[model samples]
Target: MHKIAMAMLGVALLGACQDNNVMPGPQDGRALFMANCAVCHGADATGNGEMARAMAKPPKNLTLIKVRHGDTFPRAKIMSIIDGYARSKTMTGPGMPEFGVLLEGDLVPFDSGDGIQTPTPRKLVALLEYLESIQAER
Candidate 1:
């Protein structure tokens, strides 16, 4: 099927880039980005990838987050956008799909001083870190 072919292609591409600047880590944020985001965000996170060309609304310029938010990176907002917790205004269509289940890993607990706590997914954290790393300098 198409999904199977795409998965195979992704593995091949990841293998091809193993020797490049993609750093190795327990989480390997760059690998995650390349696997899940590069098709739409481009390998450099410039938002001009081929998928963006096909979209009615071009993908966001991922590199400019810092510039857009007054030189302060909005971690919560970025994560929300990625997991579909929040919808970004720039996305005029359903071009960006929710990767919530794909981004889920071990649950992490966080308390907001209320009677309850929320568990955050680890892969989401890794993806957020990857996005933060690629932000353009202000």
Candidate 2:
């Protein structure tokens, strides 16, 4: 519930900032991923980024999300992980940084595979869409 509130607040705040520079389309997702995630997740969407060796737990092989999730990509879970609200405090080692910047653009409706029409950050939604697009076969 707390996460939902926070996400809604972000959506409301971002709704007013339409002029902010944002990459909220699949065409721009590759650049967005490179700028923010490539250093950790790799340009190939594999776990073998340059920083992979340094982390206590290696980054995930992003290309295999669907394969790992029973051939169904978990959208809400992945979104929370990327936005930094789903990880627990007891989680040890380094993880992906909270991309607050993703919440500074526009708002879009995302179902997260659920029926609820949660308002989501446009950029974050774009990132999610991009991740889904790169899923490899099991």
Candidate 3:
């Protein structure tokens, strides 16, 4: 009886330890942006967030026409940079945190299976789309 109880407990614990991974949608992207990016990137994606003044380097005005390179805003470049896959001297500052690990699309267990860190590919793509939507035309 004792051995059977222990086996059941172990199985229960194993099930509880499973990683909770969920794919986000466009609304999820907006929520994620508002929660994580809005503090530095602004609610409008304008780069004029509340923390803008405390940092040594001000965030880029993402909506400016001059900010876009060439004829089109580089979407892939922006995504890579946000994911921390791309490194830039200009992107360095206290305000920006490296998000590569968070964006790596790995499933990791959290406390009591209540929380987990999962990749938000859709959210990321949506964010890029949002940025593109707001980019000033040349």
- The TM-score values for the models, in the order shown, are 0.68, 0.78, 0.58
RMSD of 3: 9.8
The lDDT of model 2 is: 0.83
Residue-by-residue lDDT tens digits, candidate 2, 1-138? 999999999999997776544436666577789889999889998988888888988999999999988999999899898777897676556766777788886677778888997878887888888998899986
Best model per lDDT: 2
Task: Give the Cα lDDT of each candidate.
Answer: 0.72, 0.83, 0.63
Backbone clashes in each candidate structure, one number apiece? 0, 0, 0
Error of 1 at 62 (Å): 0.7
Off by over 4 Å in 1: 1-27, 88-94, 109-118
Q: What is the lDDT of residue 106 in candidate 2?
A: 65
Ranking 1 against 2 by TM-score, winner: 2
lDDT-wise, the better of 1 and 2 is 2
User: Quick one: ranking by TM-score, best first?
Assistant: 2, 1, 3
